[model samples]
Target: MQPFVDGRYNMSKGRSAEGFDSLLVSITSNTGLTGWGEMAPLGSFYSAAFAAGARAGIVEIAPHLLGEDPRALTRINRLMDTIFRGHPYIKSALDMACSDLTARAAEVPLVTMLGGQENDMADLYKVVTHGSVEEMIANARRIITEGFHRLQVKVGGKVHDDIERVAAVAGSVPKGTVIFCDANAGWTTYQARQFVDATREIDYTLEQPCVSIDDCLSVRRSLNKPMVLDESVTSLEEMLDIHRKGAADGLTLKISRLGGVTKTRQIRDIAVDLGFMITVEDTGGAEVDTAAMAHLSLSTPEERRLHAIAFHQWVTVRTATNAPPVIGSRMGIPDGPGLGIDVDLALLGTPFFETSH
Candidate 1:
């Protein structure tokens, strides 16, 4: 059996600077091979489920890897897919951990193995606040001065309010910088369309303006500016559909959201094939995903300026002493064994292991 440690970090948001944390996993094999991955949804309860998922994935998949060559990762991933159906996220998390170990054993970086090189990076931005026009502009000003022209602002649940939210954030950014408003599915089609119409004359993208993909497309077809799908596109099939139907012109690809790097790459291929924009961003906060997300986005050619990944460690964590994953003005692909990150195990607080037979 392998011992996988979880790093739970409490990070605050720059916009709100509220304390947010996530559970990151460090899976170690008996051979001293270790791979890193971040589990989804931040909370103590979410960590419990993430731990459960990791244990389940490792217990079921690790044995097959015992005598087999770890370099045969493709075969192992395929086996996991076939053996454990409908567990892509959990499987992906496991695959990322194992891939880190495999590449380290071979002394090769994960990017090269996946036919990738460190290039094209993106600057990450987070949703600051939901308030009056002046307040939104103030937040936008602060973000822009902090080297973030790319932005994502929040909107409450109301048609009138959503419109104001869009206009306010748009007016706040430096003349040419990009800005996007995340309704987080807080608007109705009619309400979303009003805001989408407003976006046509601005310098930003619209994300999850409405509820489902169906509603999103309904609004997107009537607009000139492209839309980005996040909560809606959580899988390969969803990505294919969005690209085929033109429901969305871009995507916010988070490794944790789409499982891990393996499937995240698959989604990237799909997006690239359809000539759609792809942004490899993280799910927010101090999860190990920040590093993995940076590497994945930096490695992909299509995700250079289109991606929004940056140093949020300061606000997220009190002390971000680790040189903040810098990649160009935005973020670039990192070169190293596994995710090219050295995790300090001692940083993780009390970690407990739970096994499932």
Candidate 2:
């Protein structure tokens, strides 16, 4: 397990200590080529997934994938879905490995497979985990000094305390900094309304203020600032439903949550056509997952991309060599083929489960 640089990652619903569990999956073809994938759930409470559950799901599904062609992503995903019902988190790593293998086979970067690179560099946003008013402000300032102009401040505590935290941070930050007050679905409709109503004059976007789509829509109606939905959006159908109801001005596209790059791309294309601002990222991972997020974000049109996260920067471990570097507030993808990084097998240790025909 890797430890977080910030010691603990405290969100609205759960807290992660040391760090979260990161699962690294590597697939090797009979021709002696390998592709890598990773999945890291923040915490059990944060999503409907857990590390052990993902492992169990993989054990139940890996045998069926033994002889399938890695390049046939759609068919592979369909098989996994047909055999296993709804554990997208479990299928994410396998889907990612297939994508990496396909791109490597074509001798092109993963972004090329996903509609090409629209922008080589993607802007980043730092999360200010839930903390005291003073602590949160200090974290915000520290992140700004690190050259990140976009900040996603975690709120969703007591309604009044959350209000103070967001207001204080907004006041402390320099002008032109983009602030996103993300509640992570921690509030009720009444609480969300109160928070937005109290902070109406502040210049910042409100994100996932309540638990349900109906509640979020109610909050969005009163919110003057842009509203972006996360956690609550998991499938393409949900994305369409939210868009149809005009519930959100933007959405956070988490690769793992949406299954993997395959489904994420589908949703992304539609989101682009529908004209929604997007923040492309993942649930969490070291290098492999970050690479996938970066490639997808880079392929997205710059004008519509709000920001993407360098999740590798959050952890104090190395899973791959030559991972994409974060230069100031922007990050550029590696020019190499596939996910563009070399996994350090020595660090990964022995696989808990392995199968071959």
Candidate 3:
């Protein structure tokens, strides 16, 4: 699926793109149920994942799951890890498909399979893509007018540009509206520190200002704003390290980075136990990806659930339905069985791969 603004609007890792693309994996169970999954990398630069690598990984792992019980998500995830060594994002598609099938087997929604729903709806947030101060301010104003209370202001450019852009957005948005400046690990420790120092008087949150946990920790000491870790928190051990060190004020937990809902749930549980604020999301994707994230967000306590987005809303294609509706400032999970959305086989075209056991 292509983003509305293409690549000019989304910026990270010193790269920009015209549209986002993803690899979709569909598993057809013997019970005649189909489970869908999506793994989308934002032009291969935002994260370690790329579309090509994900497809190759799936080719290497799919045969192993040919006849395995779809409900054995843990076993499946472990097997994929044992075989692939790394590339959790690639394995995420399979994990999501298995979990979807498991929920279908139980005749329940994915959120119910995850756990009893703690939130009837999920709050939503918007991203103001990296741009000039005026453009970002305009974006912020538009998002706030649309009833969104939370905004993620993309930073990570030159320190002065980032500071000015952030300040502009803050000035434009309503007072008390939540604003987070996400650098996407685009800055050095010094740049991050400088921005934090300059923005000391603003009511804005900082997210992954630098690329490394150590660097971010160094900058954290000088900032009074809440700090959120995104690109740097990739593994369970890393998460534990952050928890042990009190690394940041919150986390941006992506389903692709941690594998899928199974591992994400484990991490979410830990985050809740540590009393850390958490937001669930994927790297980038269409409806399938959003559905998985929505269900996970639904299971999280509202107070701790920062916000999640239906990224598909930014795209032009309709891959699945029953996705969580964005009701004003909030989103809700679909009540349909399993993922609560149906993949449109027609849109997928001819299968690039197919096998039956």
Estimate the TM-score of every prediction: 0.80, 0.98, 0.97
Best model number under lDDT: 2
Clashes of each: 11, 0, 3
Model 1 agreement with the true structure over 15-50: per-residue lDDT tens digits = 222333444555666676767655444332312234
**Model 1, which residues run further than 4 Å from truth?**
1-21, 42-70, 79-87, 118-120, 198-200, 285-287, 302-305, 311-324, 327-329, 333-335, 354-357
**Model 2 lDDT per residue over 70-143, tens place:** 99999999999999999999999999998998898889999999988987689889999898999999999999
- Kindly report which residue stretches of model 2 are placed more than 4 angstroms away from their true locations once superposed: none
Error (Å) of candidate 2 at residue 182 is 0.5
By TM-score, the better pick of 1 and 2 is: 2
- Residue pairs clashing in model 2 are none
The residue-level lDDT of candidate 3 at 208 comes to: 92
Candidate 2 lands at a TM-score of: 0.98
Residue 279: error of model 3 in Å? 0.4
